[model samples]
Target: MENNTFPLYFNLTMFLNLGSFRYPTFVLCFLLYVFIVSANAVIIMVITREKNLHEPMYLFIVCLCLNSIYGSTGFFTRFLRDLLSDSHLISRWACFTQVYVIYTYASYELTILGIMAYDRYVAVCQPLHYHSRISLRVVYRLVALAVIYPAFSVFTCVYLSARLPLCGNEIPKVFCANWPIVKLSCVPTGLNNLVGMLVSTTTVFLPLLFVLYTYLRIVLVCRKKSSEYKSRVIQSCLPHIVTFVNYSITVFCDVSLSRINVEELNPFLGVILSLEFVVIPPILNPLVYGLKLPKIRKVVFKMLSCLKRCH
Candidate 1:
């Protein structure tokens, strides 16, 4: 009965008109989840089956798609179930698990993007050294760090929240997130907040800065090149810039919406805003890369033509 007594579950209070819109929302989300998984799977399969695409860049794209699947699975499955259910409560362990997966996915994405930028930088600015510099051993190490560092940082945040004495059980969003759970603690969360800020800086901002720096260096190098060389840079780097910008905006919106007071705002709009990063980026990343990368695009078209012939 005490405020510090930890309950085994907490009710999510963030769905908008759940009873009225349950069926429609569930069907739509189910379809979207299916599409996201399928699209990412097709890209992963194409990359794996094509031996020519077995380079570092394609490997990182595969990792990105894998992360998209990993992250979306954390949110959409439980989300679809809750849409049709009367009770929208999640267990303590489940909430923490979701928190870990979602945040780790976010962190890994930035790391991958940063690595991609570095890959582009090497290919464009130091063409002679690109292959020698970005060896398989180097790529594997970076990939491991991308996966491990985020999980470690998120684990610390979640572990700290787990140790806290919780005084509330209501989450104001459709899914479990690190900050919202921390807000439920009855005790002072200064240390948790501090650790969280540190993690965000190291994981998100640092990687973003690295990406920007790599692009800037690439631009400076491009200024001295011929028109054909400049065009080559644009063809390869443009998609990355677009992907980075798109992801940055959606993620910023997601993080900002989470921290601000939105109880007075339209609940439907708020829910939609929260879901943007999850829904948009997974679908967008693969499509953008598949359409923009010439080699990948040609392979995709060839595969489609073959499928058409068989049918």
Candidate 2:
């Protein structure tokens, strides 16, 4: 296709065959979206409202839950709409907008996780200096870094993909993504690929490595401590570890699906993998934190009891 003849809308080809299953799938997805939003929102609300819970750790959890809501809203709102509609077409501007929201959401996830790891590290390895090190001013700076860095990096990526002269517009998956759009380019995408690799390394792998390193130090610190002390440390760290590992696996599934030949795979499996990163983490983060952390759990239970009494 000529540069000037670029299509105004892209067909999200993945949704074309839902047929009779569409309504059921739409209902399931709609419910899932609602739960994700409500769960994350409760986490945010609980953390923010309770003064005792307003530590560096809980504040980070609030950031995480807020990001979950932002990311899920970006995807699930449009997704639920798409599920019920006969047409799967998305305008070029809207497609790029989704690309920005989703990509930034992902980037924010890793960055926030990285900061959370740092927070845990200070709290565990240097307890005496935890407050001094992770002071209110420092927390603000870390949060700012987490938010700003991702926005800038993902924006560059989306800009690169958006500027490409596309030869096609049938995005194979359920949602708009940078790689699929880049793949549609009629011309060479060496620069885009190069920058993407650099961004991925900085935003994804570097944070992952940092988390690993922080945990390693925490482990070494635990070696000299009493059983009770070790158990306490484990209790605090377990939720972050679980959240990190779960998110990493989901991200891997989505990234691998994007790069691989999906034609050989089952269509249902393809959709599942595509939706994994967006769906699983948002729901899981709240559950893991709410159930695992004693303080948060107590607050949550207390809130439930009050609600019951009110009812």
Candidate 3:
């Protein structure tokens, strides 16, 4: 076949691993998808239903939970389908669409975390001015920035990749990703590489740096306070810190996986690494916030109690 001709569909090679265990894997994955959806939906519902939980912090948690559901749906619907079917081929349009959704989900996660860090910084460092600084207007603007910036940046990257004339159609992973598609291009992809790096830096690293800086300032502020004040700070900040660190590590594993030769690694390990970002954060985010934050914990327990009594 000539390198100029592009295939209509791309084969996702990773599904080959399910050889004898396809049915069991499919059932397990389906249950996981259900759990991710149910957990995140409950968080969103609790936040929106309770008037007392309508603060900026909880609002951002709602956004985070929403993104988890969004991202999980994008991956799981296709993943579950592939696990059951013999064919793992995805159409070019669908492939690009998955890339867009998953990438934007990742970008939104980082941006929201960064915003949460700033919210904490203001609440802890400037208690008297926290309400004025993180007002409803500011929260709306922050949410807007988190949405708009990542959408634009990731759209550009996906747009560039979709325009390329691919020489091959095999994607080694379970999902369609921008980089693997770019690797199949018959022509040089200098422009794609440059833009991918640029987008990654702006969307990923910049937010990471901002989050780190905010936490540093937060730590410094805590140093001057008494034990009681420090205790409160730890209680409030612990969940965000845990969430951020967990997400950062998973993202690092994913980014590192992209650069390395996945073919050389153990197939099970490679698949696990590839699945980390999509699987871990969605499940963990709700658990962390729902358990660690007293307000959310109280509301969740109350809702559960009501359900128990109804039965």
Off by over 4 Å in 1: 1-4, 18-20
Clashes of each: 0, 0, 0
Assess the local accuracy of residue 208 in candidate 2 as a C-alpha lDDT between 0 and 100: 96
Candidate 3: count of backbone clashes, pairs at least 3 residues apart or interchain: 0
Query: What value does the lDDT take at residue 116 in candidate 3?
Result: 97
Local distance difference test values of all predictions, in order: 0.89, 0.91, 0.92
Question: Can you give the TM-score per candidate against the true fold?
Answer: 0.96, 0.97, 0.97
Looking at model 3, residue 232 earns an lDDT score of 97
User: In candidate 1, what residue range of length 10 has the lowest lDDT sum?
Assistant: 1-10
Q: Score candidate 2 by lDDT.
A: 0.91
Say which prediction, candidate 2 or candidate 3, comes out ahead on lDDT: 3
Candidate 3 segments whose C-alpha is farther than 4 A from its true place? 1-4
Instruction: Compute the lDDT of residue 99 as modeled in candidate 1.
Output: 86
Model 2 TM-score is 0.97
Question: Model 2, range 1-311, lDDT digits (tens) per residue?
Answer: 45343678888877647789989988888889899999998988999999999999999999999999999999988898998888989998899899999988898899999999999999999989988999999999999998998899889998888888988878989999999889988889999999999999998999999999999999999999999999999999999999999999999999999998877788889988999999899999999999999999999999999999999
151: Cα error in model 3, Å: 0.7
Clashing pairs in 1: none
CA error at residue 74 for candidate 3, angstroms = 0.2
Off by over 4 Å in 2: 1-5
